[model samples]
Target chain A: MLNIKNLHVKLEDEDKQILKGVDLTVPAGEVHAIMGPNGSGKSTLSYVLSGRDGYEVTEGEASLYDHDLLDMEPEERAAAGLFLAFQYPVEIPGVGNLTFLRTAVNAQRKARGEEELSSGEFLKLVREKAKTLQIDAEMLKRPVNVGFSGGEKKRNEILQMAMLEPKMCILDETDSGLDVDAMRLVAEGVNALRSPERSFLVITHYQRLLDHIKPDVVHIMSNGRIIKTGGPELALEVEKNGYGDLLAEVG
Target chain B: MADTAVLAAQTVAAKARPAGTALAARLAELDLPTGGFTRAARADAAARLEAMGLPGARDEYWRYTDPAPFNAPTADALAYTDRESTLFGGIDRLKLVFVDGRFDASASDALEGEGLEITTLAAADAAGDHWAADLYGKLEASGQKPVKRPFAVLNTLAAVDGVLIRVTGKVSRPVHVMYRRVALDADVTVHHVVRLEEGSELTLLETGGIGARSNVAMEVELGREARFHHIASKRADDAKVGIGHVFARVGEGALFKSFTLSVNGSMMRNEGVIEIVGDDAVAHIAAAVLGDGGEGRFHHDDTVFITHAAERCESRQVYKKVLKNGAHGIFQGKILVKPGAQKTDGYQISQGLLLDEGSQFLAKPELEIYADDVKCSHGSTTGALDETAMFYLRSRGVPKEQAVVLLVLSFLADALDEIEDDRLRGDILTRLDEWLTSRASA
Candidate 1:
């Protein structure tokens, strides 16, 4: 469902390259895990796919279902079924969480040539989805992520993913700040949405998240390139003997 | 030494002479009303205006906002766009319509209601004895100290029409003052006086444009334990130049809240001066302004001064402005606590969201506390939209324009929150959304 080939990116304001020529693809219905250390360009690849600013693509191409993701705006990419779960969800003061969710859901639907949901229909749908994520009425009423805890922010991201129901999801370090229980809850939420037509590219620094939502494949990314790809046991090897062993072996 | 002193005196006189001449020239352009109950107040106001001598560019209060537009002798002609007035349409109200600063009795509702007494300023001035006579310009005059507001003085002296409302008990329906301008070059001034007696409650709503160039003044007096709410929305007339002044005196245990929303205007200035004289009183003044200079020269200013003179009084000032395309916004707010006014609580915040680099926001926030036991805090911020927040919204599938509108509304929510009534607040929000949406498409 998602493809990236030789994607090279550099900081727009600086001459330093971030994502060197590196690529990996995740097919439909597959949950792929990307494990890497700091400054490995795993997050950069996700950002490039989601159409974030402050990055210049010097070379290579990334597409979703054969649609050029680089040429589309962030909103357009979102309407094209691309979703990124931010590590640090933005704190938007004054825009209520429910309002943001409703606007986003309706916006994507409208962009995709679908009828907008009425307020009642939206309230009901959101309540049902929020019930599973344990997000209460007060959290939905408050401004988006303004005072949310780290775990709540991650769960809120999952809620957005569920609401949008995108074809391809990119989880960029969603488990970074979450506790064990929170991570399990979030993983459960993600696992529930897994389907034959959906795909996920979970990016993380640790293998703990994979224990909750099992991945079909694991890739060790380092130096802006995926150096190794294997089964779930590859994550176990890395967890047993960190990326230090893998990097040295690959070199 | 003697020569130096003489030079200083000569400099002071040199400055006064031209100011005097300019004030006289501007006064010559006004046809002041004569032989009425307000004649004495008007004459006093004129004397005060002469002493202050139209606010100059170098004046401290006028530094951020030029007073030239309001001081002009003639108003430029502007076509009065004919459209149905839609604001506050769903609310059942006692409608009072004014056209070109003249009260249109035929178009307005009957001036009598339960526990309410309303009259035109002209009629009140004509009568020998009326309760409004005591409050004609008393608050405006009292608010003149510590600062000079010559335009308010000018408005009091040159006002052609206004409404005088006195509420003795709870008023179920709001008094809606709707203004419409028909004359292209109408130079209009209106002075509205509201008096809420002890234990009384009332809501006053004002909307629309008075003229091409307008000066509007409102004096409000809240008696002991009285509650008063005032909300106003300026007509989105791109060519209009309007200055609005509100002077209020809140009494013991009384609650006074006033909020204003301005969507458009070439040059607009709103001044609010409130004095909490009695103990345990509460007062709040807020404004939400949106300006797009692409339409014309949009310069909007909100100047507020709140005085806490009684023990245990509370006051809040909230002003927010959203500007784009080279628009300029100015906020000058001050909180003053007098001696013996212990336990005084005062808060003030003024923020501006500039949508583009060309737009600018200037703010001057001040607090003077003579009482050591007072709690007074003020904050001012001016910045562009948070790019991280913008991306978060857009990435969620909201279009860039829709994201901007959402962010702008979010920036204005605090100011809009000052309106207590849900229906009134909803109406303002709807109007604000409409304004932002139209600009987004444009």
Candidate 2:
């Protein structure tokens, strides 16, 4: 469902290259794990695909279900079924969490030329989904991520993903600041949303998260390129021996 | 020493001569109303105005705000628009309508109500020795120390119409004063006096400007254990000039709260002076201002001063402004704690959210505490919207314009929170949302 080929990106304000000729794709109904070392351009790929600013696409292309993601604005990309779970969710004071979620849901639906949900319908739907994520009414009423803990933020992101139901999801380091229990809860939430038409690109530095949400493919990215691709066993090998041995073997 | 003293005296006279002449020229262009009970107060204000002269750009408080528009001989005319105003429409209130500063009895409710008495200034003057005679301009005169407000003095002298209200018990309904303009070049002046007796309560609502240029003043007196709430809204009308003043005195255990929402205009200046004289009194003054200069020159100024003279009194001042397209906003706020007034608490905050680089905000916050045990704090900030937050909203499929409006409303929530009534706050929020949505499309 997602495709990238020879993607090269550079900082808009500087000449330094971030993602250089790296490429990987996730087919429908499959979860792909990208295990990378520090500064290996894993997060850059997600940002480029989600159409963030401060990045210039120097070469190559990225697409979601035949739609050119690079040419669309961030909101349009969102409407085109591209979602990125940010590493650090923004804290917006004065905007209630529920209000933000409702606005986003209605906005995306309107962009897709669908009928908007009534307030009652929206409340019922959000309550059902939030029940599974363990988000209470108080959390929904507070300002967006203003005082949320790490686990709550991740769960909130998952709730948004469920609400939008995007076709392709990119999780960039979702397990960085979360405890083991928190990571398991997040994994369960992601697992519940998995379907035949939905695809996931899980970017991580460790294999603990992959243990909960099993992936069909594992790719090791380094120096802005995916140099190795294998089955689920690849994650185990990396966990046993770090990227240093892998880099040596590849070289 | 004698030579220096003579030189200083000559310099002061030399300065007063020019301002006195300018004040005369301005007063010559208008007619001062004459009445029975207000005659003494009017003459006293006129004399004080003549001595103080009209405010000029050179004045300390007028540095950021230009006084030329207010001191001009004739007000600039604006093209009238027929947009219907929905301010306070959802509330059950006693409606008092004014057409170009003249009271329209046909559009107003009956002057008699439970727990309160209302009368026009003209009618009260027709009756000899009215209760309003004691409060007409007393608070205003008392507020003219340590600073000079020539425009408020002029408003007292030349006001052509007004309302006088006295509350004696808990009021169930609010008194709403709606101003409508029918002439393009109408210059209107109005004064309102409100007195709340011991253990009484009242809420006052006001909306719209009187004309192309308006000079308005309100004086409030709160007795012991009384409560008073005031909310005012000025709609978006280009090429309009307004100058308003509110002088209030709070007694023991009394509560006083006032909030204003002002939209686009050519120029506006709102001044508030509040004195907490009795122990355990509370007072709060706040405003939410929005300005866009694309239509015309938009300059808004909010100046406030609060004095705490009794033990354990609390006072707060909150002002927030959002400006874009080269608009300008200014705020000057001060809090004072007198000696022996221990346990006094004062808080002040003023902030400006600029939508673009062209807009500007200027603020001056001051605090003077003569009591060693008093607590006073002040803060001011001016900045653009948070870019990271904007991206977060847009990335969630919200349009850029809609995201901006949401962020702006969030920025203004603090000032709007000062409104103690839920319904009143909701009405103001709805109005602000509508204004922002319409402007985004425009």
DockQ values of all predictions: 0.74, 0.71
* Candidate 1 per-residue lDDT over residues A105-179, each given as its tens digit: 999999999999999999999999999999999999999998999999999999999999999999999999989
Least lDDT summed over 10 consecutive residues: which range in candidate 2 chain A?
A86-95
Residue B168, candidate 1: Cα error in Å is 1.2
Question: Candidate 2's chain A scores what TM-score?
Answer: 0.99
Candidate 1 C-alpha lDDT tens digits along B1-442: 3233223323334555576565556655666665267766776775666567788899999999888888877888877678757899999999999998889999999998887999998777666567777888788999999999989988887787899999999998999999887888888889999999999999999888688988899999999999999999885772389888999999999999999999868899999999999999999999999988997789999999999999999999999999889999999999999999999999999999999899999999999989999888899999999888888898899999999989998899899999999999999999998888987976
The TM-scores, one per candidate, come to: 0.95, 0.94
Q: Residue A62 in model 2: shift from native, Å? A: 1.0
Cα lDDT, model 2, residue B144: 92
lDDT of 2 by residue, B317-436 (tens): 999999999999999999988898999999999999999899999999999889999889999999998877887888889888999999998999888888989999989999999999
Number of the top TM-score candidate:
1
Q: What are the per-model numbers of colliding residue pairs? A: 0, 0
Task: Report the lDDT tens digits of candidate 2 across residue range A1-251.
Answer: 89998999999999989888978789988999999899998988888888888999999998899899899988998998888888899888778899999999999999999999999999999999999999999999998898999999999999999999999999989998999999999999999999999999999999999998899999999988898999999999999998989998889
Worst 10 residues of 2 chain B by lDDT: B1-10
lDDT of 1: 0.89
Model 2 Cα displacement at B336 (Å)? 1.8
